[model samples]
Target: MRSLFTIGLIASWYASNIGVLLLNKFLLSNYGFKYPIFLTLCHMMACSLLSYIAIEWLKIAPMQRVKSRLQMMKISALGFIFCLSVVGGNISLRYLPVSFNQAVGATTPFFTAVFAVVMTSKREGWITYVTLVPVVAGVIIASGGEPLFHLFGFMMCIGATAARALKSVLQGLLLSSEGEKLNSMNLLMYMAPVAVMALFPAALYMERGVVGITIALARDDWKFLIYLLFNSALAYFVNLANFLVTKHTSPLTLQVLGNAKGAVAVVISILIFKNPVSITGMLGYSLTVAGVILYTEAKKRSM
Candidate 1:
C-alpha cells in the first residue's frame, strides 16, 4: 500500500509538472503572454492560498510552529530562492523552445553534485562522478546546434536550474539541522506567501507599466485567464506532489524521476510545438537522458 501510494504521488508530480510546462509554454510563447514574473507571482499567490486551506482548513498536514527565528529566516531564504528559480524558468520559456529548455534543465543533478561537494564536502563514489559527465556534455552539444537558442534564454534556464539545485541542498541542510522541522505542506504554507511577496516587486518592475495591456488582453480573452488559473492550480499540485514524493521515497528517487519527467516533457513539447531538432541535438539529448538514468542506477548501487 505504501509503495502504491508512492507510485501515485510520483505519477501526480510528473503529470502536473509536464502539464504546467506545456501550459506555461503555450501561454508565454504561443499565446503571447509577455510577463513571466507576473505569471509566477500569480502562481505563488495561488499556491499560497491553496496551501493555507490545505493546512489550516483541510488538515492535510499538521502545522508545526517554527522553533526559532533562525528557522523562519531559513525558510524565508528558501522562499527567495524559490521565487527566482520559478521566475527564471517562466522567463526562459518565453524565449526558448521547451525541448531545449528541458534539455538544459536536466543539468540540475550536475549542479546538485557540485553544490553537495562544495558546500557539504560530501564525496561520492567514482561512478557517481563519472555519470555527471554526459549530463553536462550533452547540454553543451545541444546548445551548439539548437535552432531556437537565445543566449539570454539559455542563461536564465541555466540559472534557474542551478538555483533549483541549490534549493534542494539548502532545504535538506536547513530542515535537518533544526530540532523541529515543518513538513512540506506546512513549509509551503509559509514559503508560498513569502515567495509571492518577494516576486511582486520584481514582476511589477519587470512588467513596467504594462498592467493595462495585460488587463485588456485578459478581458478580451477570458480563455487565457482560465488557462492561467488552471496552470497555477497545477503548480500547487506539483509542489504538493514534490514534497510527498520526497517524503515517501528517497531524494535520489525523486532526482532520477525528475530526469525522466524532463525527457517526457521534451518529447511532448516537440510533438505539440512542432519544434525542429537537429541530429546533434537529438543525440545530445538522448545521451543526457541515458546518463541521468545511469547516474540514478549508480547512486542506487552505492547506497
Candidate 2:
C-alpha cells in the first residue's frame, strides 16, 4: 500500500501538472491578460477545498503528526512566496509563448540542483555539472534560439525557472523536520490555503468588477468562471502530487521530469491552440529531452 501510494502520487503529479498547463494555455487563448489572475485564484481555492474534505472526510493525512503553529506559519510563508513566483511566471506567459515559458521553466532543474547543494549541503559529483551543458543547450535550441534573443519573453521563462526551483527547495525545507508527516496531502493542507490568499492583493489592484468578469466570461472571451473554479481545484492536487513525486523519487529525477514538462506542454499548446513553433524551437525541445536523459544517467551513475 505504501509503495502503491507513492506510485499513484507521482503519476498524479505529472498528469496534474500537464492538465494545469494545458488549461492555462486554453484559458490564455480565449481570455486576455486577466486569465492568469483569476485562474490562479480559482486553482488554489478549489485545491484548498478539496484538500480540506480529504483531510476531514476521507482522512487523507500523509502521516501521523499534526503540525505546530510555528510550523504552519512557516509553511504559509513558503506558500506565499511560491504563489507569488507562479503569478510572476504566469504573467510572463502573457508576453511570451507557452513553449517559451516552459523552455525557461526547464531551468528549474539547474536551479534546484544548485540550491540543493547550497541549502541541503548535498553535493553532486563533478560529472553533474558537466551534465547540465546539454540541458542548457537543448533549452536554448528549444526556445527558438535567435527569436528568443529578440524577445524579452526569455527573461520571463527564467523567472519561472527560479520560482519553481525556489518552491521545490522550500518544500524540501518544510519536510526536513517533519520527515514522516511530509507527504503530498500533508503539505497541501497548509500550503494551499496560504497560496490562495496570496493572490488577493493582485486581484484587488487589477480589479475587474463583477460586470467585467461576467462579460469576459459570457462573451466566451474565456470560460472565466470555469477557468477560475477548476484551476483552483486542480492546482491544489497538482501541488500535492509534486511533494509526492519529489519524496518518492530522486530530486534529480524530479528535475528531469520537471524539465520534460516544458517539452510536453509546448507540443500540447501548439496542437491545442495552433501556436506556432519555429524549427529551432523544435530542435531545442529535442535537445532538452536529450539533456534530461543525459543528466539522469549521470545522476544514476553518481549514485
Candidate 3:
C-alpha cells in the first residue's frame, strides 16, 4: 500500500510538471505571451494566494508564524533565490524549445552535489563525483546540437537549474538547524509571498506595457485567461505534490523520480512541439539521464 501510494505521488508529480510545462510553452511560445517575467509573477501570485488559503482557511497545515527576525531574513533570502530560479526558467522557455530546456535541466543533480559539498562540507566518494561527468557532458553535447538554441535562453536555463540546486542545498542546511523548521506546505506559504514581493518590481520594470497587451489579448480570447489560470493552478499543484511525495517517501525516491521526469518531459515536448532534435542530442540526453540514475542509485546505496 505504501509503495502504491508512493507510485501515485510520483505519477501526480510527473503529470503536474509535464502539464504545466507544456501549458507555459504554449502560452509563451505559441500564444505570443512575450513577458515571461510577468507570467512568472502571475504564477507566484497564484501560489501565494492558494498557500494562504490552504494554511489559514482550509487548515491543511497549522499556520507557522514567523518566529524571529533572523528566521524571516533567512526565508526571505530563500524567496529571492526562488524568484530568480523560476523567473529564469520561464524566460528561457521563450527562446528555447521545451525539449532542449529539459535536456539542460538534467544537469541539476550535478549542481546539487557541488552545492551540497561546498555548503555542508559533506564528502562523497570518487565514484559519486565521477558520475557527474556524463551528466554535464551530455548536456553540452545536446546544447551543441540543439536546433533552436539561443545563447540567452541557454544561459538563463543553466542559471535557473543551478539556483534550483542551490535552493535545495541551502534549505536543508538552514532549515534543519532552525528551532522551528516548517514542513514543505508551510514553507511554501511563507516563501511564495516573499517571492512575489521580490519579483514585483522586476516584472513592473521589465514588463513595461506588457500588462495592457496581455489584458487586451485576454479580452479578445477568454481562453487566454483560462490558460493562464490553469497554468498557475498547476504550479500550485506541483508544489503541493512535491511536498506530499517527500513526506511519503525518501528524498532518494524523489530524486530518482526527477531523473525520470526530466527525460519524459523532454520526450513529451518533442512530440508536442514537433521540435527536431539531432541524433547527437538524443544520445547526449540519454547519457545525462543515465548518469543521473547512476548517481541516484549510488547515493541510495551509500545511504
Candidate 4:
C-alpha cells in the first residue's frame, strides 16, 4: 500500500510537470499568448496563494515562518533566480519544440556539478566528472540535428538550466543551517510571493501591453481563463508533488525519477506536438539521459 502511494505520487508529479510544460507551450506557441513573463507571473501568483492555503489553513504542511531579515534576503534571492528560470523556460517554449527544450534541460546535472565546484570548491570523483562529458557532448549533437532549432530558444533554455542549478547550489549555501532550513513546501510558501513581486516590474517593462492583450484574448475566448488557471494550478502541483515524492522516497530515488521524467516528457511531447525528431536527435537525447543516469549512480556510489 505504501508502495502504491509512492507510485501515485510519482505519477502525479509526472503529470503535473508534463502537463504544465505542454500547456505553457500551447499557450505561448500555438494559442497565440506570447507573453511569457505574464504567464509566469500567473503561475507564481497561483503558487503563492495555494501554498499559503496548504500550509496555513489546511495544515497540509506545517507552517514555517521567516525567522530573520537575512533569511528573507536569501529567499528573495532564490525567488529572483526562480523567476529567471521559469520565465526563460516559458519564453523558450515559444520558439523551441518541447522535445528540444527538454533535451537542453537534461544538462542540468552537469551545470549543478559545475556550479558546486565553482561556487563551493567541492570536487567530485574523476569518474563522476568524466560522466558529464557525454552530457555536454550529447546536447551539442542534438543541437546540430534539431530540425526546429532556434538559436535564441536554445540560449534561453540553457540559461534557464544554469540558473536552476545555481539556485540549488545557492540554496544549500544560504540555507544549510538548521535554523534556516525550510522544507520544500514551506520554502515555496515564502518564495512564491517573492517571485511574484520580483516578476511584476520585469513583466511590466519587458512585456508592455501584455495585460491588455491577455484581457482581450480572454474576452474573445473564455476558455483562455481556464487554461491560465489550470496551468497555474498545475505549476503549484508540480512543486507539491516533487516535495511529497522526495519526502516519501529518498533524494536518490527522486533524482532517478527526475532523469526518467525528462525522457518520458520528451516522448510524450513529440507525440503530442508532432515535432520532427531526427535519428541523431534521438540518439543524442538517449546519450544524454544515459550520462545522467551514470552520473547519478556515480554520485550515489561516492556518497
Candidate that would win on TM-score: 4
* Model 4 agreement with the true structure over 1-303: per-residue lDDT tens digits: 999999999999999999999999999998978899999999999999999998889887888789999999999999889889998899999999999999899999999999999999999999999999999999999999999999999999999999999999999999999999999999988889999998899888999988888888889999999999999999999999999999899999999999999999999999998999999999898889989999999999999
* CA lDDT for candidate 3: 0.88
Model 2: how far residue 87 lies from native, Å: 1.2
What residue runs in model 1 are displaced by over 4 Å at the alpha carbon?
1-9, 246-250
Error of 1 at 267 (Å): 1.2
For candidate 3, lDDT tens digit of each residue in 212-244? 888898899999999999999899989988988
Compose the digit string of candidate 2's lDDT tens values, residues 99-161. Answer: 767666665667888888888888888888877777788776665563534354567557667
Shift of residue 19 alpha carbon in model 3, Å: 0.8
Writing each residue's lDDT as its tens digit, candidate 1 over 1-303 gives 978888888889989999999999999989988889888988999999999888888877787888889888999998899888999999999999999999988888899999999999998999999999999999999998898889999999999999999998999888886575677788888888999888888877878866677678879998877898999999899988898798888788788788778888988889999998999998888888888888888888998
> Is 3 or 4 the stronger prediction by TM-score?
4
Off by over 4 Å in 4: none
The per-candidate count of clashes, in order, stands at: 0, 7, 0, 0
**TM-scores of all candidate predictions against the true structure:** 0.93, 0.80, 0.95, 0.98
Q: Which lDDT value does model 2 have at 257?
A: 72
Q: What is the C-alpha lDDT of each candidate?
A: 0.88, 0.69, 0.88, 0.93
